[model samples]
Every structure is written in C-alpha cells, then in structure tokens.
Target: MSTKALDAQPKFAQIKQYIIDNIRAGTWHENQRVPSENELAEQFNVSRMTARRALSELTDTGILTRSQGLGTFVASFKSQSSLLEIKNIADEVRLRNGHYSCTVLSLESMAAVAPIAIALGVEVDSQVYRSVLIHNENDTPLQVEERFVNPTLAGDYLQQDFADFTPHEYLSHVAPLTEARHTVEAIMPSNEVCQWLGLFNEEPCLQVIRRTWSAEGIVSFARLISPGSKYRLGGHLTFKKKQP
Candidate 1:
C-alpha cells in the first residue's frame, strides 16, 4: 500500500474516504479482507482509534463487514431497480432486466392490533401472520416489505419459500380477491430499514401502504418502502362510457 499524504479532514473521515476511494478504484475487491486497524494506523500515521473509526463507519454503512475473531472485509456492491406494478418484488426485478432475490428477515405469528384487525375485518386480537422481507435488485437493496396476512384465510404462510415464490402468487392462488387499495407517500427510513435498503443519508424513500380484500373480507395489509432513487409508483384508470 502507498503511504500518500492524508487529506485535511478529520483523521477518521480522511481514513474512511481513503478506504472508499481505494474500493471504488478496485484496489480492494469485494469480500477481500482489509488491513487491520493497527496496520492501517501505522500506514496512515494515525492512532488506532482513528483507523478503527474509519472501519467502523464503513461497516455501519454496509461498505465493509466485520466478524468476531475474524477480520473486516469489503462488502459487495448492489444495484437498484425501477418497476411500477402491484406484483412480486422478485418478479419485478427479474422483469426489469436485473437479478431478483429476497432475504426473509422475520416470520412470526402475532396478534393483530385494532387497526389491523379492522382493516382485515377480523376480530380484534386475532392471530395474524407477519413477515419482514428485504428485496434486492441485482444484489442491491431496493425495498423492505413489512406484511401482515389474515391467517384465517392464508394459513401457514410462514412455511413457504418466499425466495422462490412471492406472497402475491401464493395469495392469488389461495385467496379470493375482491378489491385493492393503495396509498403512497414519502418518508425517511428508520435506521434498521435504511440498513435493509442499503441507503445513504441523502436518499429518500417512497412509502406505499396497501390493503387487499377478498370475498370474506380484507385479506392482507402491507407497508412497502423503497429508496426513491430506485423506485416510482405509477398507474392508469379509465372512466366508464355512458350510453348515448
């Protein structure tokens, strides 16, 4: 490694930018282990804490990853997708000429809250299925879907292979649909959600609140939020023609 003069920024910030620049320049490849904090400090003529801050910030930003008893390594870069449809995120990615994948963050059975129950037309405190899914386009985080399903209609949803099949596909096969509603807005992502989406501080997100109903009642409710730079929602409606 060359010992270039560090920039005038804070030692940590300077070190952070150095690492990022090297990574961008391809000096550090994906999954490649970076130098230890002590080594970096020696190379940069800084304290170990300063070097550690650089690595820590990168890790927090998902540019690098650290493992206990192991070492820090470069994180893989990701790409985003733009698809406007009420469909499976994985399918959307695939259709957009990108690779599609998902990570199931959590799957559990929980009691529905009053608002959720009312939306699903189920009794308050009824058992409901909840799932948190992180969908990626071309290995880049695109959206985080927090979904709730009426277990009375779609039972054992937690057992399905979401990576291979979408909730929309499974629901369409099982549930009888009647109506659908959607509301879109903008919001800042939470820390956890931001990590899930691999978003930077400047990136805003488009938040979509959706509800689907069946003959029996409301069947599902979901909150889907995507990085604004990566997604946009669009639709078209036509009015009925009156007989002359």
Candidate 2:
C-alpha cells in the first residue's frame, strides 16, 4: 500500500486527516484492519502516543473501530449520527428519508419556577414561555419536546408557528449561541408524555434535557422524550490540549 508523506501539521491532526482521506479514497475498506500503532508510528516517525491519538480520534469520529483482541479496523459508514453537533429533529428525520410531522401541545407565557429560575439564572417568578410539541417520523411517534423559554431573552416566541419551523432554527437565528448543557437518560414516559408519543405504558423512552445560553443569558430549556424504538443517540468525542 502507498502511504502519503506526513506534513508539518500537528501529529494527531495529520494522522486523523490521513486516515479519513484513505477511507474516503477506498484505500482502506470498511471492517478491514489497518496498520498497527507501532507500525504507524514508525511510518510517520512520530511517537506511539501520536499514533494512538490519530487512531483514537478516527475511532471517536466513527471512521475506525478498535476491538479488544481483533485490532483496529475501518468502521462502516452506516447510520452515523452527528450527536456531537446540536441537530434539529425535523431536519434529522428528513435526512433519513422519512416523513416528519409535529403537533403543538401547549404554547403560553408563564412565571419561572424555582428549578427553572435556577436553570435560567433568573429571579423567581420571572416571565418565561413554555411550549410542548410531539414529533413523529413516518407515522411513528418519535420525540416529545417540553420546552421553557426565558421571555426576557427570547422575545415573542409564543407568537411563532412552531409547526412550520423548529425552535432550534428560530432560536439559532435570533439568539447568539454561547453555551449548552445536555443530559440524557432512559426512563418510562409519563402518562401525558406517553399519550402524546403513542407509547405503551411499559415502553421505555430516552429523555434528553437541553439548556441553551445566549449573549443575554440562559435563553431556553427543553426536556425531550423520545420513544426508544424509534430513536437512537450517537456522537463523536475528541480530546484537546489545555490552553494557558
């Protein structure tokens, strides 16, 4: 096999790009084992850690798979998810060639409760907006989104038609993103959430809670419940050096 000459880029980044390019070029077929870390280090004249970093990054990016005793192999590019990136459910379903639809359950203005106040970094009883929507894909219920918006930041949210547009698309254009926190868990859906999602009483669901901040402060908080059968979560992870 012909190997490309390494450039002056960072060791890990160069390694990652090399693997990606090779995979894209079909030099390394899916599920096919690549060179060993020591062999790669020798070829690149870099340390083992650098080679490991490259392989780890590819593994995290779903380009490679590391088996316990079978060694590292190229990963299959099937149903790969952009979990690391914040995605709109409607858009994701469309990408999968599935029909997508949503029903708005509630959209109103209210006062932030204690937990909400703490989440939004606002005073108790501050004005907030709440919305609940159930999303379906190909006629199968998928996700139920229960969202709270800090009206002080996200203005006139209740007036918008969410059925035509997603909150993520709207807020991304309106608010400058600053930070985000995501919490994921598996649980049984509540009676109301289950009814909205068309899930049986014993069916399990995936709960995802996301809080987003803008330049003004916490702008939105959403609790999403997804039917386990219809939804699966996937993402990539990377490690970076600390800045001084």
Candidate 3:
C-alpha cells in the first residue's frame, strides 16, 4: 500500500496486510526472511513497536516464524490432523506432499504409574510397553508421540522398528481400533519438550491426550505434542437439509 493509503487507516494493520499480500502473491516464499522491524518502520514511517506488532501477530497466528537473532521468515506448511477420526501421522505429511521421518527416542517395558494405569485401564505397577518418538516432516520436528501400550493386546510391541512404521500403524495391525477418544489443550512447553521440538521458550504447544480401545479392552494411552506453529487439528461436516 502507498504511504498516503497506509496513513488513512491503522498503520499497523496496513503493514500487516502489506506483508500478507506479498506472501500470498509469492513475493515471499516459505523460509524466506522478510524485512526487519527497523526496515518496516522506516518504510512505513511508523515506530518499531508498530512494525513489531505486525510481525508478532503474524508469528502467533502461524503465518510467520521468528528465530532468535535470525529475523522473521514465512512459516513452513503446517501439518494437520483430523478432529473426527484417528489418522496416521506419516500419511498426513505425505498427503501434503511433504517427506516424513521419525526418531524413536526410547522403547521399553515400564511399570505403569497411577495416572497411566487409570488411562490405560490397567492395574497400577503393571508392566506396560512404552515408546517415545519424534515425528518429523521434511526433517523438521513435528510431533512428539509418547505412548503406553497394554502388553496383553500387543505382545511384541517392543520388537518392531518404529522408525519404519509408526505405533499407530503397528497397533492397528495387532488390535484394530474399536473406539478412540481425544482431549486437546494448548500448553506451555516443558524444557525437554522444547529441546525435542526445537521450539523457543515463547512458543506454545498443542497437546493431545488420546486413548484407543480394541474389542477386548483399552489398547493404549498416548500423549501427542506439537508446536502450535507447526501443527493444527480440524474437521469438516455437511448438514442434511430439513423438510421444508
């Protein structure tokens, strides 16, 4: 927008729109660093704080990402999940034409704690299979999957290569899902979570507490974490028409 036009309305909003317009027009591609606050302020004849607000809002909404000492850049394409169904993470990334990979951090049998036992419908201190993994999209960390499995249902849980096939894929093969439940929350990331996801301290995360059931009983309890700027959950529905 021209200086005169920008002056006609809220300058900060106009600056935000200007950046968004450039991005939409492909003038600024993904991972391409945009102008600094000082540059933007100089261009728009506004204070740095006004320019900073424009950048900050876009960053919070996932349109842009700011790296410490590295200026702002357009955000990478976000990974998305279904709110209506259980879907595999690998498939979700590939559906967006992005490469998918995973790192299996830990896989072992552990005694269930009370909360885990309650979630998994198991007795406290019972042996359960636990796996911790980081799912990546295009080599960038996307989701942290920490799961506790009912050993009776998936007997060979620890033997498989999770880097080759996800826990969701393997569990589905062993004990097909009869039902699933999910609870989502936005939370501040722990230091460990931040390190795993390569997230800054200010970035919030989306946490999903999930439980899956098979014909016999509860199969697993899982905690899924994703950086708010890197992942989203959504669903679409169509309503039937009523008789007029």
Work out the TM-score per prediction: 0.62, 0.65, 0.70
- Top model number, lDDT: 3
lDDT tens per residue, model 3, 1-244: 6778766878898888888778877999999999999999999999999999989978755577899999999977676677898989998776444589999999999999999999999999999999999999889999999999999999999999998989999999999999999899999999999999988666889999999999999999999999999888876587999999
Runs of candidate 2 with Cα error greater than 4 angstroms are 1-82, 238-244
- lDDT accuracy of residue 10 in candidate 1: 74
Compare candidates 1 and 3 on lDDT and give the better one. 3
| Tens digits of lDDT, candidate 2, 1-244 | 2334556567777777777778768899979998888988998889999999888877764567899888899876542435477888787766544578888889998888999888878889988889998877777777888999888777879999988888888888789778888888899877987789876656788888899988888888899887776666786577898999
Error of 3 at 45 (Å): 46
Model 1 agreement with the true structure over 106-171: per-residue lDDT tens digits = 989988899888877788888999999888776877889998999978987988989887787888
Candidate 3: Cα lDDT at 59: 75
Candidates in order have lDDT scores of 0.79, 0.80, 0.90
Candidate 1 vs candidate 2, lDDT winner: 2
Model 1 scores a C-alpha lDDT of 0.79
Q: Which stretches of candidate 3 lie over 4 Å from their true place?
A: 1-76
